[model samples]
Target: MNAILNSARAELLRLRKWPAVWVTLVAWLLLASLFGYVFNYVAYKTGGSNFASEELGNAQIFAALLPENLPAVLVQGMPMFGGALMMVLGAIAAGNGYAYGSWKTVYTQGPSRSAVTAGSLLALTLFVLGVLLATLALFATYTGLIAATEANTIVWPAFSEVAKSFGAGFLVLEMWMLAGYFLGTVARGPALSVGLGLVWTLVLEMLLRGVGGLLGPVETFTQVLPGTAAGSLVGAIASGDPSAMDTPGVLNVLSGPTAAVSVGIYLVVLALGTMLLIRRRDVA
Candidate 1:
């Protein structure tokens, strides 16, 4: 237990000092703001229509940016860009150790490999939590300002709803991060791991999902993919009207419980797989 704690602390310190980690977090914030508030708010003010606001009236657009809808705004972007950035974070966090030969040094002199691996995973989980909290804070600030400016009541989302959204967002981000970590371990480097993970998340999954629409077996297989599960979970939380959803990756393929369970399974499998691979293989 002590070893794990110490290892976690060490990993956290390293991550804290890493520039790439902050850059990824900042990038996500910018994206969430641009899509969640900036565009919609602009369209509402100008009575103009964009992709997201095309179907939404000015009233609806303005309402979507209020504090009451913060939970939805928070997780809507997680299925796509949010997950991809997290994957990059995870890939680099694990793969960079090999690039710099730090893993070899640590494994040679540190506690058991299991302890070190557990520590690293713990640290990564903490980082994911931080990202969510930061995003929530940013969204609250934006919405609060908008509500005050518009003289609208600042109705907060229900505690239960916020908790549920937070949990779902955590699951989606952590799953992708762990997937990246597993890829990094398998590839033994960050470059290939990050590239392949991004392609899988951003492109390949979408392509397969598109083809799945035409083929029965392919559609069935895509139901279990990470992107599908993530999108479905977000879709379930967001409005149920599929036609109203203009977000790129949000889908309504599976039930909420089913998507949540699949995401949980992926999270567990990826974490365990990365640990097993690192423990059994040669770090040197």
Candidate 2:
């Protein structure tokens, strides 16, 4: 237990030292802020209902955030954007230990490579959750400020929902880190692991979905695939309005339940893969 905690702490310290961490954190903030900015501007231009009133229940508050005629592209892509950045960040977090050759030191400090890997993954999980929370807080504060002077009420429950969505984001982030860790250990190439991790996350998943669409009943199978599942979970949480999608097509397929199942499968796959890799691999 002590070894695990120590290893997690050390991994956290090392993560803090990486420049990409700062960059990715800032990027997520900026993108979320951008979403708030555009929504606020549109609301200001049009006579939108004030969302600030506590009278407005959770559903009502949601209506205020997503006005009618909201573009589908932004709605579908916005939440995924944060997850995408997080996935990249997770990849870096998982692979960086190998890149810096710190896994050797971590293994030396712990009795086994498995313990060290678990500790490192634990630290990354905590870090991702913390970041997600901070992002939600900031988004709520900013959105409230935007709605305040302009007839928007601080919808507390809606903010809670946003926080929940952010938690979903953290789930995806953890999966990415775990997947990267397994790849890191198996491939023993930080560059390959990180590269493949991003590709599998950003590209391969999309391709699978597209190809699955062409084949009958393949979409169901694809949904259980790692990227699709993680992506769906985050997407469901971040979707503020139903009409946010302009063209209601495949992008509209994701629902909370579907995402939950997808993400669940991803967790199992990552866990089993990590354990299998750790058991077989020797610490350098």
Candidate 3:
């Protein structure tokens, strides 16, 4: 346990020193800033439109689009800010180990394979979580500034709503990181993992969705994909009011319990499967 903890700490310290990680952090902050300003700008221009997201399972109607509210900003800006970019960030973080031969050094220090894997996974996932935290902070700061300066009403989000948003963001971020970690571990390079995640999420997923729609019934298949699952999970939590999704971008509207279960399954399956595969394969 101590060994694993130490390895996790070491891995985190090492990842913090990564230039790519720093670059990603900067980009994430920029994204949060951009989202905050742009969305608030929309509200600022429109004098705060009353466009609310509708519910999926609750049969609720649309409410107003409140830019001053934290939950509203999270649900509205997440598709633009987090999704694919964060996946690439996760890929870069995990794949860098093999790309730069960092894992080899860690293994040489006599840590057990389980400990090393656990530690690396813990560090990488937590690192992304830190990024998400920073994202929220920056976004909140920007939105607050907008509200204060632009004369928009500062309608605060309920504690439950903020909890849901955090839950959704955390789940989405972790799943993306795990997916990238799996690719990084198996492909053993940054390029393939990063490229594959981008291509898979940005291009292939959309193409498949298009083709699936044409074929009919295959839309169900898209629901099972990691990206879909992540979106669904976030949609459920981020829009806790269910009716909060007037123009929910790519949110699946899956019920909260169902989406939560789907996310859990993806995490557990990928984590266990990756561990098993790495145990048999040569990362070096």
- lDDT of model 3, residue 174: 76
The per-model lDDT (C-alpha) reads 0.89, 0.60, 0.66
Clashes of 3: 12
lDDT of candidate 3 over 20-110, digit per residue (tens): 7788778767765544345435543554532332122211221222433566456444543466666777677667777888777766766
Q: lDDT winner between 1 and 3, please give it.
A: 1
**Candidate with the larger TM-score of 2 and 3:** 3
Ranked by lDDT, the better of candidates 1 and 2 is: 1
RMSD to truth, every model: 1.3, 6.2, 4.8
Considering every candidate listed, which one attains the maximal TM-score? 1
Q: Write candidate 2's Cα lDDT for 222-249 as tens digits.
A: 7667666655554465454432332111
Residue pairs clashing in model 2 are: 51-153, 52-152, 52-153, 52-154, 53-153, 72-245, 72-246
> What is the Å distance of residue 78 in model 3 from its true position?
3.9
Segments in model 3 whose C-alpha atoms lie over 4 Å from true places = 39-43, 46-68, 75-81, 238-249
Ranking by lDDT: 1, 3, 2
Q: Tell me the deviation in Å of residue 230 in model 1.
A: 0.6
Candidate 2 or 1, higher TM-score: 1
What digit string (tens of lDDT, one per residue) describes model 1 on residues 1-284? 99999999999999999999989999999998898888888888899977877777778888788888887888999999899999999899999999998888889998988999899999999999999999999999999999999999889989999899899999999999999988888887899999999999999999999999899999999999999999999988887332225788888899899999999999989988888898899887
